[model samples]
Target: MTSTPTRSSDTTSSEYDSDDTNQSVHSDDTSSEDIEEVDEVVDNVAQGDPIWECQMCGALMWYQERKDNSRHSTVPKFQLCCGGGKVKLPLLEQPPQLLQDLLFGNQSPATKNFQTNIRTYNAMFSFTSPGMKMDTKINNGKGPPTLRMQGQTCHRVGSLLPLPGDSPKYAQLYIFDTDNEISNRMNSVRTNKDIDEEIVKKLKLMLDQNNVHAKVFRMAMDMLNDVNFQDVKVKLIADRKTDGRIYNKPTVSEVAALVLGDIDSASHRDIIMQGQSGNLQRIDEFHASYLSFQYPLIFPYGEDGYRPSILLRFVDDTDITKKKKLTIMHWLSFRLQRRKGEALTLLCSRKLLQQFSCDGYTMMEAERLNWLRRNQSKLRVGKYRQIAETPTTNNQSGPTLKGKRVVLPSTFVGSKRYMDQLYFDGMAISNDRPDIVARVFKIKFDELMKDLTKRHILGKVLAYMYTIEFQKRGLPHAHILVFLHPTSKYPTPADIDKIISAEIPDPKIHNELYNLVRSHMIHGVIP
Candidate 1:
């Protein structure tokens, strides 16, 4: 998740830190089993044989052919290291140039020095060389592309049939095809449109000066929208900045109720919703505890990633103080230790967050005992119920109350589901691909701008904002807010008709245009 400002009161709070920057939690202890195994294998392998090692944790491996060739498998099975990262093998020999450089220490120093000084020395020695004339007729690359921004004049991609009295359609297509010229032009336009730099500058100024008024927030938000969309809207209003409010802070459930319904009368609901909500809700106590171990949601006292915003999803009965203790103690005992391969496997598997929470509650119990022992002198008689109430049984048996604590599931599932349904989420092209969806949106936006500029539409664009969101079914759609140029703004019914249409086009009169419009432009019943 991107970093946002933490509550100002949290800066001095013993419960949580406000200024955590690191995202990753590394293991404090290293496993010795892999090291021993690798050392034993290393002693057996011949000196010149090829060996591969994991880059993450220094685990080594070797390829070995299986004897079961009759099974029809032709590939050798690789023995991977404990680190579970991509394997990289060392090059057996250095390159010729590197070897020469190391042995002779760079013999071309004089040549390098001469080349460096030659340009200036030659300028003094030769007259014409210093005052050489250059051709001024050559085209210096500048200005917008050859294609007009007007939609009517701009040719579509790959329309390559010859015209009757002019250049072939192929030639027109060739201009866009050469070296991906169209893509380059689109990229240039996108760069010019990007207002992130301006937004960041203004945002920093507003934050630093404590001038984050409602209008300032709206201005920053407006920068995220397009300038050529039909309609714009903002939701989820914030009345005031909640930066430093800690003592009088509202709980997550309270805030949710305030936003979603009447806060005074709102009742606690299950974190996970069932049925049509399609949420994995109503998690049992055991499952919730197990989840808490993995995610640190229940006892997130010392967890750097923990935020007050996360607790809003839980039921009212959850013991916040106890949860905090568990989270802190869990981290304290283990200190994030794990087998690298196992950790990775758990991270990527169906169980997503399994490693952090351990089996049984022995470690947690031990931690609690240690704390009780240390604080015995400070404790008021029968003050804390956890220790005072049924003290002997609670301490000995290890927190067996099934419903005593509840954990909410991570938001990862719903988020991934939404992204998976999207037609373009950047990940559609490749694992590492970025901005694919954004690029598609920008291209279509540019086309809209082109149409508006040429007066093919009723009004000129002044400014606008747009947002693309994925539906539950995984399709991507855009919501646009258009700001029209005042001079060309349409106020009458006839003026609106110039750009908006409801009836289907006449196939005979419109022909190709009719077919294109009918095929793509129809909307379903509004209600």
Candidate 2:
């Protein structure tokens, strides 16, 4: 590794390790070239410069410059928390960009996008026109009425608002754009705190009850899968559907008996068989796979016109465990059924019904767990170093914080398709409904993939994985990963740039495009 300077104040900076979890001391293994590099670093520090070392791990080192020691000087003396002064240290290497963003805030030195590379455009226009008049017609109730205004002219009421035809002087003006309007709206914090507290109180009670329900549901399903209770599934389905005096609804105790007892419970089977049109109609065919009972936790159950939850089933037994198949089933279910269309209603086993009898998860905890699992292995900083050896960004990390250079890490990884979906959601708003964003994301993503396929940007899309995430400001963003045909991989910067842009577009020729570029694409200076 070549020597690269680091900030003297960054105490967190340390030697790069292959694995973050492994904290054992490094072995005294050194190549001749590494020893020479260490010697050179020692020679530079021995001249008079000081160095910083980790308080917890004394192995890592960072070089620091000597500051004035006179009482009158403003410069502070360098010291380590472990009660040690700067000392000559062996060579150390820099960390990855991902780590740098984590240790410090995200800093972009090489890329122009990090800085304000484009100027924000401001324009002002008014409908007012000079030397213009509006003619007033008699109010006979025959045609539309016309009125005159001092500063502007009016044509027919239904015609598009036209600008003045004559040449006029112009002046630059600044006004809030659509994006600024949304930002302003987001900035307005709701004054009432009690509403949130009450909501939390209700939510907590709901989650606790749901957890109890989920445990019961899981237990019931397990019991139904038992060999002795082969016909129990049919009884449960019949019990749910039957609603007359001759046939009785299964009580919770009877349901418990069916789950806890053995011997097939002939009475339960009779009740189910007689309730149905046929006596013994393919009982095994009615049994659902254990995986078919999956139910997603939903909140504000009252507003959802259908039952609070559903006993989700797949198209076939083979698709039961496949998450994608389940997702597609749900998508179609809603698109066909919930959208005021016809949907085939299958008999849900009583065991599956019991699982959703109560709500079962805290939205906050569920969201947290889901996010943790989703991004557990996403790209992150391993090591990072500053681009220049000028003044340290932090006062604690002083000058002479030099170290060996390391490779820059990837900017993003995981799923590109999901990220694109998220970008599109942020750009568009529809019907003032929050839940719609999820559907919109899926729709837009499909269209985007289809368009990309037509252009052969990445060749035929083989498969894709995606997730929807909500922003703090209440907008949904999508994260997706696409698998493409081997021949369609983006191999070079030029090939990638054909589909993506890093720089601002020229405003003179591409006025409309420039507005979009400035509003969304630009990444401002890192704080």
Candidate 3:
């Protein structure tokens, strides 16, 4: 059997090659060292073959293997990565004209520099690829090839140039086209029973009325719909300064006024009165604190604010004659100083800090266990008598009730609610098991046992045992031990070599298996 070549063969000859070869031959009269240097230069030039990039997949190919060989071909087409002109994809919409002109069209030094160093800019903004090394001589050339994953793998996008008559793709597709957006939303909601036709209609109306991007889309559409490009350009130039002057920028006070909304109003006065009388609710205090409402931006589901009692206590303690109220600045200063000292003191003792963390963890675990015990009746396995009495098709010959006590699941490590419960529904993984991972593992182990014992994957199996273990990273792995029949056991080196080989499989022959092994089985040195 012959193996297929990994890359295309370069068969095209050029005038450049002929000219270089002739020059090298004529220069042979020079010194031997000079002739050798000339030969090396010729070899280097020959190795520098012309490469063509695919217009569809951005994959590099030999110029000789290009689908289009026309003299005027600006964009080369290829057949290997994407089927020859078969794959039709929507194009990414061009950036706004102003942005395009600023970035690419302008002849300014900044623009020229940006265009020249675009790759550098991209590398600066994007993630860096890691460097890795592998020992190729580990187990000789016949052993498994040492491999190291040096970087993250990502999809290579094709050229951004829009195809003729192709619709906008990606974010632009959803942003600008209302009908397309609505249709997409409808398709997404088709399977959801809660969102009916009426709800969808209401949603469409809401999007039409309140969608913030609608104005931007309308402006873009207006630009596209202009009958005379010159007139639109003139109008834009004329209104540029006027538009800038007309746009009112809100001040800090104005923004505060908008958020607070008429402090002298009856509702505001009532809240103020409640606060003054020490009768304000926690919700009122929360709304009063600007920091607490905006805390979600920094920490999701987080709140930051002082309780009414704390504020009152601060005011009472600070006032010498109980006459003056503590100002916001004073309260903030006090809190900041208090927190700084506390943090510093905590940092001073490592053991004490560790003890605190351990105590907190212990408290949390205790609370979780208490909650589970209190809610045991809510779990499916709580009704152990009913489950024991229930007849099972597989257990017809065995006693229905083996024990009275409900056994807890071994898989529960208090990670999530689904994993913590003894039994979620009528179906129990064990007598009272939980967690999808545990269930999946059990099913897979059963399948393996069936293959070994019943299917006779390795002749007749005398005995077999397996243990599932979790690595330090919490990922589960299995170790299996099989005792095969005497006839099936590998007695010779040849038989052992046939059964077990430590090497990467040929990708061309076993593509799926090769990919699986490369992705999951390959291990590299930890940084």
Tens digit of lDDT per residue, candidate 3, span 32-122? Answer: 4543443344343443433344544344444334464432122335554333433222112233332244244557754454344332222
Instruction: Please report how far candidate 1 places residue 394 from its true position, in Å.
Output: 82
Error of 3 at 487 (Å): 32
Q: What lDDT does the true structure give each of the candidates?
A: 0.31, 0.31, 0.36
TM-score of each: 0.15, 0.17, 0.17
Task: Report the poorest 10 consecutive residues by lDDT, candidate 1.
Answer: 123-132
Find the 10 residues in a row with the least total lDDT in model 3: 233-242
Off by over 4 Å in 3: 1-164, 171-211, 226-527
Local lDDT at 414 for model 2:
31
Model with the higher TM-score, candidate 1 or 2: 2
Shift of residue 25 alpha carbon in model 3, Å = 89
Model 2 poorest ten-residue lDDT run: 118-127
Ranking by lDDT: 3, 2, 1
